[model samples]
Target: MNTSLKALAVFIALAGSAWAEDLQDLPDDTLLGEVVTATENGEEERLLDLMREVQARGLLMFPKPQTCTFSYPDTEFFGNEIFRGAVRWGFGTDLRELAMSQGFCGCIYDLGSLDAFTQERIGKPAQDATTSDFSVFRKYRRSDWSDVNERYQNFQLERCGS
Candidate 1:
């Protein structure tokens, strides 16, 4: 009986060590973070971390303005320069709300920033606020307003209970 108990204990110890070794060999993604510490350039790491969090939370997106002068270049509806600036500098959430409420265009602000620039721009978890899922609304638009509007409208309808 004593010899058998010793053998059992030895087997348990070996199994435990093997399990620990397997855990150590697991990938970084299996952990909570990317673990880019070895290449830690502070600025780059900070930016990458923010980007990772944004992607992880799925908030790195935004829609386009519905009534963009870009589509009707000849028509100056809201003072071409003013309209452009408004799109550039205006709060993304406000723009999204305006599009859904008034225009054909739809907007979604997905950029993750904890600092509140405007009431609408308070970036938080998507589960916290439905609108925080920018990817659900529109992708990061560079130019095509029409595509952005279409995507946003679909997203709003799907996610925001439109």
Candidate 2:
């Protein structure tokens, strides 16, 4: 890794509880976190370990984690930024209340592993993405990924009752 990337990882790892609220739009299998960092974006097991380190420190989560991968060039609305990539992002709803009653309707965070095909799209999105563009998955939280996604799903289920 480059020095800048390494420094970024260190900075993220040592970040404060404020990270508990920082949000980013990542593709499926991307773990939901702020301070959590990984050396291998393509290694699922390694990514999970990184996420667990964050959870172990009580960072963030998405209970009942689900995922979707956009393999072709596609765009999705993630908060404000429009990301274009062969994306893999964690999926969930607003079940943060279950994790802790002390959160705001503030930030939605992202975390997880991804293959090299996924790239972060920059600039204005050509168009909004539809369901057809993504391959979705629903699974359990055995690791940081599973636990985070499970929380996300549970949050949505609990809040929306769907």
Candidate 3:
């Protein structure tokens, strides 16, 4: 091969290897944190890029197992619901469509219900809560996962059902 072709091939190979390495190094929490930060900053383009990267890498092949925690006090619990709603629904149609296509229906439904629940409880827009407020609420919540999926399912059925 000519010198130019040889250099181009080497560059492509290096870029491919670097991308594979980056995908291997990415963790679920890291990806989730980046998504949350993007939402907080209203970085729609960044969010779309991250979602595209996730799809291209096949990082989230299956919906992550849901973990329901019912130990949070009422305020913190409600705040978390609002935060999750904001984070999920905050994504633009393109991002939401990408995620749904990738099998994130359950997550979308659950967070949507959470957002609806907060609206009913507070009787106002829950999007007013800041990311900082969510961080503080998260700090106080129990890390232990509870088997409260049934309760949430019922709520979703009631609040998010067509």
Candidate 4:
């Protein structure tokens, strides 16, 4: 099979597996709704919390005894780290919007045409340090700044300001 076909197969497998997990333990309906909305907007695919919640809800929605139990890590994602990284590189406005929407203070780093989710742990700097630099995971490295900008423009032209 070609690479695209292989990727499709993997996607199918993961989606199926994800659909089979349960999450009745989490009870915050508001958070659940936010997650669902963000996902629908194509933003939270790489968010660990959102993904975990989705898996849980999928399991509850499916309710199969033969399903597998999955686990997620304990970490803070998107917000702080994306800010620091983007600021370090002096990214663009759209990229900054992406980070701010995810929790960055501003968008200084222009990822060009790349879309990424910064999903890493937050770290604390020493008192002597001048900046609060953090690390993030490119969980969804397939997206870039240009992709985001184009999408935003299309959204505005097609949906918002029309």
> Highest lDDT, which number?
3
Query: How do the residues 1-162 of candidate 2 rate in per-residue lDDT, one tens digit apiece?
Result: 699997986675545333432222222133343223444335365465556544433334545443433233333432223222222232222223223343222233322212211222222222444444333221212135645656655644543232
The TM-score measured for candidate 2 stands at 0.20
**The 10-residue segment with the lowest total lDDT in model 2:** 112-121
What's the TM for model 4?
0.21
Q: Candidate 3's residue-wise lDDT over 76-121, tens digit each?
A: 4345666654333332222334333443323444334434433544
TM-score of each: 0.21, 0.20, 0.23, 0.21
Clash statistics: count for each candidate = 1, 25, 0, 20
| Over 4 Å off, model 2 | 1-71, 74-86, 90-143
Task: Name the top TM-score candidate.
Answer: 3
Whole-model lDDT, model 4:
0.39
Q: Give the worst 10-residue stretch by lDDT in candidate 3.
A: 139-148
Off by over 4 Å in 1: 1-86, 89-142
| Candidate 1 residue lDDT tens string, 50-107 | 4454343333245233433222123342234544343333345444544454422122
Higher-TM-score candidate among 1 and 3?
3
* Model 4 lDDT tens row, 29-116: 5435545544554555534565565453332333345432211222342234554344223234345455434432212243232222
